[model samples]
Target: MRVLGVDPGLTRCGVGVVEGVAGRPLTMIGVGVVRTPADAELGHRLVAIERGIEEWLDEHRPEYVAVERVFSQHNVRTVMGTAQASAVAMLCAARRGIPVALHTPSEVKAAVTGSGRADKAQVGAMVTRLLRLAEPPRPADAADALALAICHIWRAPAQNRLQQAVAQHASALKGRTR
Candidate 1:
């Protein structure tokens, strides 16, 4: 499966694309940041974000988009921007009919580093090691995006198994009724 993970920010949104299946290593298809001027108006920043994400979707055509869920924290301004960026990401995926999954930062950190409260450096280090890269993913956002993809890969099996069980049960019930 090809998954695009997004770490949304008004000024600098980070995106990473990885292709892999459960229990296997992931291949990095692409990784980059979408930058908008910090002084830009909120509407303008959002428009830029939408356009950037659309272009990325057109280019990569990922099967799924994984985004970080917004958490209410002390910084109201940061939270607002994060929420808006996430909205743009979801809208972009919805427009293209691509499925989206939202994961919490803690969930991503835990998946990558075995601890929900793992620090940014720890997560970055793990991302570097997992991808077998020489350097850590820069600027934190990119690292977070990679971590989000990892979280999805880890979580996907449980969901797929549940779906398969449901289908099997339905098939058995139909056979008995028929």
Candidate 2:
């Protein structure tokens, strides 16, 4: 499967594409960061992000997009920006009819480094080793984006099955009620 991972931020949103499946070697198709000036108006920043994500969608044509789920932080301003950026990513994928998945930072960390509390360096090292890259992607955010893709590539199958089971159980329950 080809997966695009997005690490959304106001100043620098990381985007990465990886192709692989569970229990198989993954290939890094692309990786980069989109930068928007902090001084730019809110609307302008969002526009920039939208354009960047659209370009990526058109260029790589990922089957799925894994975005970092926004989490509460003491800095409400920062969180708001991140949430906005994440929305743009989801919208871009939705417009293209591609599936989107949101994974928490801790979930991503655990998937890549075996520990939810793993440090940035550890995650980077693991990402490098997993992708067999010569070096870890820079600016932490880039590596994070790649990690999100890798996590989804490894986890999505079981997650899909669980969702299917839940839906089937719900359907059976509804039929019995009827």
Candidate 3:
């Protein structure tokens, strides 16, 4: 599967494309960051992000989009910006009719580094090793975006199965009620 992972931030939104299936070698199709000036007006900043995401969606045409789920932070301003950026990513994918998945930071960290508490350096190192790249992707956010894609590629199979089972159970329950 081809996935575009988005690490959303107002200052630097990371974008990466990864292609692979579970239990197979993964390939990094592309990786980069979308930057918007902090001094820009809020509307302008959001528009920049929207354009950046749209360009990625068009260029990569990914089957799925994995976005980092926004989490609460002590810095309310930072969290708000991240959540806004994340919403733009989801909106872009939705407009293209591509499926979107939200992965938490800890979930991505554990998937790539075998520890939820893994540091950014550890995650970057793992991403380099996993993709067989000569060096880690720069700016940290880019690596994080790739990690989100890798986590989804590796975990989606099991997650799908579980969803299917739950749906079947619900169907059976509805039949009994009828």
TM-score against truth, every candidate: 0.90, 0.95, 0.96
* RMSD (CA, Å), each prediction: 2.4, 1.3, 1.1
Per lDDT, what order, best first?
3, 2, 1
Sort all candidates by TM-score, best to worst. Answer: 3, 2, 1
Best by lDDT: 3
Report the C-alpha lDDT of model 1 over 1-178, residue by residue, as the tens digit: 8889999999889998878887887777888899999988989999999999998899999999999999877468699899999999999998889999999888999888999999999999998888777899888898888888878888888878999999999999999999
lDDT of 2 by residue, 20-45 (tens): 99999899999999999999999999
For the record, the alpha-carbon RMSD of candidate 3 to the native fold, in angstroms, is 1.1
- True-structure Cα RMSD, model 2: 1.3
Per-candidate count of clashing residue pairs (backbone under 3 Å): 0, 0, 0
- Return the clash pairs for model 3, or none: none
Which candidate achieves the best TM-score against the true structure?
3
Model 2 residue pairs with clashes:
none
Question: Runs in model 3 with CA error above 4 Å?
Answer: none
lDDT of each: 0.90, 0.95, 0.95
